[model samples]
Target: MSAPSESSSAPRAVNPVLAAVAWLWVLVPFGYGLYQLLIKIPALFGG
Candidate 1:
């Protein structure tokens, strides 16, 4: 048995799958934008 204050103060657990999905949600767009920039770099130099 635990105290009410201790339980309330404990940090909530996060699901790994949800965490990964959240990370990918942010990274995927960022990665795509970076790829687009890289693709355009050669164009900028007329390559």
Candidate 2:
């Protein structure tokens, strides 16, 4: 019935170690994808 509180919806503060881990979590997958696209795709296509 009542609207949700905005404060309760605010983003939580990230711990430094957790933040670094999260950044690597994103970068590792992205780097692997890029490596597959740039290197593996070219090898498959005889480039």
Candidate 3:
């Protein structure tokens, strides 16, 4: 059996713009969910 090659297994580099956009895509929803949880949860519970 042959051993795996490192050169063939390396991942392709991500584009910076796409990476930034993807990070924002994740962060925006996360931040919004946190905002709603902080502001809405207590109201829903009548606290």
In candidate 1, list every pair of residues with a backbone clash: none
TM-score of each prediction: 0.60, 0.49, 0.49
Per-model CA lDDT versus the true structure = 0.88, 0.85, 0.87
- Using TM-score, give the best candidate's number: 1
RMSD of 3: 4.9
Candidate 1: give its CA RMSD in angstroms.
5.4
Candidate 3 residue-wise lDDT at 41: 75
lDDT of 1 by residue, 1-47 (tens): 76567457658787799999999999999999999889989977888
Model 3's TM-score against the true structure:
0.49
**Higher-scoring candidate on TM-score, 1 or 2:** 1
RMSD values for the candidates in order, in angstroms, are 5.4, 4.5, 4.9
Q: Which stretches of candidate 1 lie over 4 Å from their true place?
A: 1-12, 44-46
Candidate 3, 1-47: lDDT as tens digits? 67887667669886899999999999999999999789877777788
Q: Could you give candidate 2's per-residue lDDT for residues 1-47 as a string of tens digits?
A: 67787677769776899989999999999999998788767667787
